[model samples]
Target: MNVLKPLSGSTLALLACMAAGALCGLVAEPAGALAYLFGQLYLAVVNMAAMPLLVVATFFGLRQVCELPRPAWRVGTIGALALGLMVLCGVAGTLAGALAMPGAHLPEHAYATFGERLLQSAGDAQEVGVTLFDGADAAVSQTSAYGWREAVPDNFYRVLAQGHPLGILAGTLLFGLAFAALSREQTSMLGNVFEGVYRTLEIIIERANLLIPVLAFGTAAWVSAHTPPAMLAAMGSFLVCFLACAAVLGGAATALTARRAGLPLVQIVASLKAPLLVGLTSGSATASIPHTIEAMSARLGFSRGIVELIVPFGAVFVRAGSALYFSLATVFVANLYDRPLGAGDFAVIAFASVGAAFLSSGKSGVATVGYMGVVLSLLQLPAEAASVLFVTIDLICEGPRNVVSLLAVCAVIALVSAGLPSERVMPEPLRAQPQVRAPLRFALSRGQLALVAGCAMTVASLIVLMGIGVGAK
Candidate 1:
């Protein structure tokens, strides 16, 4: 049995902010520019925290794994489970698109609307002396540049510096394994350093979370104001179809977890609400890491070590959410282009989708959508117009995607982590507990100062970029 509480205050506030922002944006679109600045600043901070969190978390998870009995088997089992589920998710999404036929039977009004949108886009492109498909052409031509080397890079430092997720994941995984394999005498100082960094970063994120509601409001306003309402209406079927698949995938995962954990569904929801809300609002699992770990371990009665291992690792490499997105988007594009989809086409789409989903990690917005073009090119579909509509109204789409991804984490843990939580440690909630005494503090370590500097520089640069955009207007 689990002891998860009801939805936390922050979760409710985030939802309210998003709703308010949507309504406000629909009514007062003029504030969008201001909102964009706030939204970017918030995301930039999250981005700043992400890489360091990844390294520290990888250390924690891998060290825990190595301590567990039969560590190699546990790692292999988790990998196989994640990979298989992601593949099935891709196939399921493609099947939903095929059955729904969202893009095939567009209303007459939608046809006119889509035609005008394309013409306007083409006009804009022509004014700049480039075709609408030029980007896709250049993109397809560069496909050869990505390969196994990029996935498991030899130049770890270069890729780490560039903030590539796959490279970071590979490098940190190997580093953590080596660290865990070393004698405690040899690794104690570095282990303590990693633990301190993780704790410090957690505190930093907790403090920064005060801006989440404002970020939600700004992000909602920014999306609503920029995207045409009519465009959303015109493609409502695709949105609905995507949402339906997400519901199926998410519901199944939740139900399975509840059944296996012997916990009631309401209790499961109570435990997960915070992380799920954060995921939906921020669309960054890294931002939800602390909430996710506590909820799964302390509230939902799973192993903290296992929860930590899966959340970050699964967020980076598993990518069931991206698999679903790629599969459905590919099928929708095929239908939109009037390309015939054969049995073989579905097979190709499924496999390509899984691969593309893995490759699209660490990317967001337009960069994430660009992977859809790779699948489209393989099937000879017109990729240009297909993505334009999706991009225009992606904010709504991303919430479901992020939520599904988070649920996938829980689902894996529930299925694979079957033991009871006998060794769980319950601490007072961070807000409820007050510090007994202030510790004697010295000046910041050089490493800590460097981290603070990096975060400050990242946020400042993004704000400056936002200002440049505002000035151009």
Candidate 2:
């Protein structure tokens, strides 16, 4: 067997391809068109896998969560904390983006460029709204990001093929829950098959990233050959907001860990230093897991089993980093298209972001950014066109994203291991919802848990539909 397993990524190959791409863009303008085609080929291949992976990953990941050997109360605590933390992170991002207006107030040229791309995503209507400022036609196209037809799938395969991220996400959630409900004995064989499939997709995508040079070159040449320079600044502004949000979350996580562990803030920071660095450099939470476990259990003195359980769970299931990124990024797109956001819009941004982050698990780099399609679709934003610019800056953003992921796990472990009791938070017959203040409280039964979950999901779905309906108008 081959030793070392090829280092598990194509980082060097990516660099080489990028060099070749840059060279082509600079020295061979005539051949630039050919390079662009190859890049398009790469994008198409990735998109083909992106949607399928969204489904398979969701199904498989949820099954694994369900299969945890822990008791029902433990599982419910994890679920509640993860969901609450993720929503908290997303809402924070939405606030930051709303106040900062990263995609708003762009310079004249950059504004027009994004506006055109927004209009372009409306395909058939693009002809009428050649410019974003084309009066009523442009106004109509901008508000058309959501509809009844798009939210509900008639045929799942067709919807997946059409690049409908929200539709795929909705379908996958229902399917994943049903699959997760099957006993391990019943799903043993199929589980192995999907596990293999998910791993294979990861490998394929990693290898495909090696050809990112092609995509990079094409994107760079296309931008340089056509657009003005101000677009770069627009992207930078968004990144600044993204990093700001990550920073805010990261600092809060550090504080929470210090308080929960009853350790000094300096000590907590020092203990977390290694994993934070790994996350910052690799931009992969999996890469940082070893360091995170060591920091939490070995250095910080949390229970080893709990540390192990919560770290990986936080890395994959929590996904607050992606949640934060999505909230800001989605709102950024809305502002780019000059779509106004009301209170309902912010609610949609926060809710859609958490859902999108769940599907975004196990993806990195281009694939991670590409999966923004889900949230964008929910908001009826132009995922296809907006992703073009977003992907160009995605690499620069990953470091902060990963760093936040590590910090989030630290905070989660602190909360789960010491901050709260390991009891279920079932729906009570109380007048007001007591679960809000102390989520995942002690002493709930299985039947009550199910009833509470059903009620929560029902209320959430109604809110989403209403928010979507309001935004689309």
TM-score of each: 0.83, 0.54
- In the range 1-473, model 1's lDDT, one tens digit per residue, is 01112222367666777777877788887675576577677677877886688778888888877887778987888888888888989999989988988788777888787877877877877752323344654665575357455668989989988888878888888888898888889988998998899888877766555566666787788777777777888888888889989999998889988997777898888788777877787757577777788788777767777777888887777778888988898887777767889899999899888878777776765677777777777777666666666777677777787788778878888776755444234423433567699689779999999999999999999999999999999
| C-alpha lDDT of all candidate models, in order | 0.77, 0.67
lDDT of 1: 0.77
Best by lDDT: 1
The digit string of per-residue lDDT tens for model 2 on 101-198 reads 98887778776766665555456444433322224334333333333355567778877777666566667767877988999899899988987876
Q: Output the lDDT of residue 84, model 2.
A: 88
- So what's the TM-score on candidate 1? 0.83
